[model samples]
Target: MATTAEYNLGDFTYPRGWFMIGLSSDATQTPLAVRFFGEDLVLYRGASGKPHLVGAYCPHMGTHLAKNTTSYVVKDGEHVQGDSIRCPYHGWRFGPDGQCDDIPYSPKAPPKRACISTKKLVERAGCLWFWYDEEGGEPDYDLPEFEGYDEPAWVNWNVRCLGELDSHPQEVIDNICDKGHLEPVHGSLNMELFENEFEGHVARQILSAGHKTLAADGGEPMTNDTWYTGPGILQSKMIGEFPSLMLIAHTPIEDGKVKVWYGLSVKVQNTEPTEEDRALAAGYEEAGVDAFAQDFEIWANKRPCLNPMMVEGDGPFDKVRIWYRQFFNPRARAGEFQKRVNGRYVVRGTNTHPWDNAA
Candidate 1:
């Protein structure tokens, strides 16, 4: 497990971005105890059914906020009230903002200092997202709309929560510019085009290729437009028999360990998906997950690549790393890193576009 400093990414140990913390189902009246960004955190829904993410320890006595079961506060169904959660140990209640709303045994008002730290969260596309910033600032980028999640002509994805990997997210991120891995690892047969674009706060890959596992034989090559919004979330639009959208979100559990999720929303050949259409979309999603697992397995077993011994046809790995450093550094200095890599780079011999114009 190599630390972020080992990579010399930036001053912050964790990057600033909107990170997926857990599945939407994980947030319920019964608070969930989970860890992220090296902090033990609690996630639960209020009476209004909105989810909240807050530090797990009660500020007053350091009791685990959501870890007890026998406490009457929990057994009496008083654990969660409205949009607030009570400590299972002492019944000290905290609001969604993490301020101590009430201390069951206290006569005087709760101290102004009595509050747990809270993480800003949003529920979307069947997952909970948290904005993480070392500077304690609000989100600097927007989370992807994950379009077609619940719209017609598309099958809503039940995001596959693939769980945690004991590896740094840097490894997972390197995939976007890793054209070399396509042919060997992902069965990307004869790659026709491979190029990357590094715009401010967005890193994109445009690929036109064939795949042994995810494509049909003797068909048009798979065309994919993939990108990362900030650093934690990635989306890919794959044009195929049924156009599909792929999502991969990874966030730090600790400095060197991270959690990951993968999902696919498939557009069906109907205005409203029927049972048959649903079944077919599910099969496509499953196949997409299978394709993703190929990369997941490698990240699980491989050692961290702090520095890649770059070679030709590698699809600009060095540039990708430089672009990723923006997230790890101070937001004020983000442009410094982005300016160094923000441009289109077409690998030689791809031959998918004219040499002068990428379009």
Candidate 2:
């Protein structure tokens, strides 16, 4: 088990996953640039109706890809078609792969080396994900198994919200394990705290809660499991190992302000949603929004260090916090910590927890 005191805030990285950029309906024919993973990336549908992500800034002179204003010359100038984004300042065109394709003023094509990097992109479950590291490392870990995602038994309702917080990623993450705050902040009961584990680049915390509200009555006390992978991915599942419901949240924008995006999937039975079913689904979505808002209020007011010093008895779920630290801290990655597993002390990187395999 890891503790809050052991977490190294500096080494935390965002996990890779499809993060919703507002909503799918908002995107039209025009290209839009969104801040993600500390950089601006452009998102637009290719001719094939699939979405694509490219560097937002032109490699030449740093002009923004979205700021250029040139009208299309064909079919009454209604559509814009080109192999790459054209820079308004110098008319330099960059291809989909972020490579410079042409310079209008130059006599010949631009050098092959003149190109901005293009990130590998995918749209899944109504969200966009950019691979910050290597391509095809493994199709992202399987999305949490939820009943509503593909089954007709349950109706799935999804909601998207954005919050700007003055806290680090870790601060927001710690909220999932802070069992003490649920009663007061969320008006929920604290059932019990389970163990947390850190394995490879993934950190997980399992929490049980019951009787949070009347609507949640008669329902099983949900076991919320949060998983953190290297870099920028965060996922939360509402069921136990058999995750019947799942939510994926990501911080696409960095700097002093963090932009958080959430997508959820619910399991529904075989039937159209009735009024009661709709109300229940809506209540769940509202609960999630309110819960995150509560966390945002606290994190926004915290100091930049994000991970405040833990005092005695401050975190009853300190084990989860510590496990996250051991799993993610660069020191642990470098083999600096000895983790005990199955009554044996093993190097941090070599030992794998059951959750890691399950995830």
Candidate 3:
């Protein structure tokens, strides 16, 4: 796999953005080990019912905080106390803010530097949203509200974790502008319209087409409006027999590897969904996952495309790559990258083209 530097993305190895680390159920009172942005991290829910993310190693003796199961601290159920986590080896307790709050054996107060680094975590929509920034800055933008979880008319998404892949996320991100793949990979038919709009940290794709995987049983064509809130957190609205708010999230596990997940929150006729309605929604979600797997399979096997061999009919791949570069560089220079590629691009060959519509 190619590295981020090989693609010439920017100075940072990983982009600064809100990434989905795991499903909400994965975080509980018991500490769980997780890796993201090329760092070992631990995730645990507090007794107060709030989830937290911190560096995996204890600051004192470099013990794997969540990796120990045989320690007395873990067996006695003292590994997690209230909202703080205790290191298994030395019993050093770190609060949610990542400061060393207590040291049981220490006669003196905790040292000034006795702390493990913490991460900013936001739990929403049954997923743990992690804000990752190399510069250690606050989130520049907010995560798009996955409101289906709260809405009465929509069935909440199951949010399946589709395991990790040994490919750079740049390959998956390129799908935003992969108009050529629709026909062959997904059996996209009669592409009436296809366009992409890039502005600020958002990259939008508008497509009107018929898909074998997504719109198989339906006679009506599907209209897909998809956008990435940042480098990760892709949300798409599918307009068809049943409208769905689809989610595709991928977080970097290492420089050239990533983990991905897919969910489809479906709208039903019921104001308050019945069991049957939920079952129907689950079926839709399965179909959506199947559609996404088409792309996932290709990304898993293909070599990295550092530079695409662009052609006349291809969508604006260069523009999409430039728009993505903003998240990798320093936030102050983000506008510089945005200004160069912020505009709507409509490619040729679709029925929406002037020549195609003519007699």
TM-score of 1: 0.96
Query: What order do you get sorting by lDDT, best first?
Result: 3, 1, 2
Task: Write candidate 3's Cα lDDT for 1-359 as tens digits.
Answer: 99999999999999999999999999998899999998999999999999999999987889989998999999999999999999999899999989999999889999879888999999999899999999999999998788577798899999998998999888989999988998998889888888899999999999998766556663247899999999999999988666789999999999999999999898888899889989999998888788889898999899999989999768889998999999889999999999999989888888767446521
Q: Would you estimate the TM-scores of all the predictions?
A: 0.96, 0.72, 0.97
Clashes of each: 0, 18, 0
Residue 206, model 3: Cα distance from true site in angstroms: 0.6
lDDT of 1 by residue, 1-359 (tens): 78999998989999999999888999999999999999999989999989999998998789998898999999999999999999988789999888998988989999989999988999998999999999999877788889898898999877877988988888988999998788778788667888899999999999998777566783358899999998999999988778989888898999989988888889998988999998998898888888899898998999889999988677788998999899898899999998999999887546565445545
Tell me the deviation in Å of residue 138 in model 3: 0.7
Model 3: residues with Cα > 4 Å off, grouped in runs: 213-219, 354-359
Q: Local distance difference test, per candidate?
A: 0.88, 0.54, 0.90
Q: Summarize candidate 2's per-residue lDDT along 1-359 as a digit string, tens digits.
A: 12223344335443334344545544444767677667787766655666667777766778776654464422232222444556556667676777787787899779887787676666655555555422224433443333355456455647475655555555666654454566677655534444455564455656555645632563346667776653355667776322345464655365344567655554444366566766666666676776677767776675654345665323423444444444334442423332421111111111122224321
- Of 2 and 3, the candidate ahead on TM-score is 3
Best by lDDT: 3
The C-alpha stretches of model 1 lying farther than 4 A from their native spots are 351-359
Instruction: Tell me which of candidates 1 and 2 scores higher on TM-score.
Output: 1
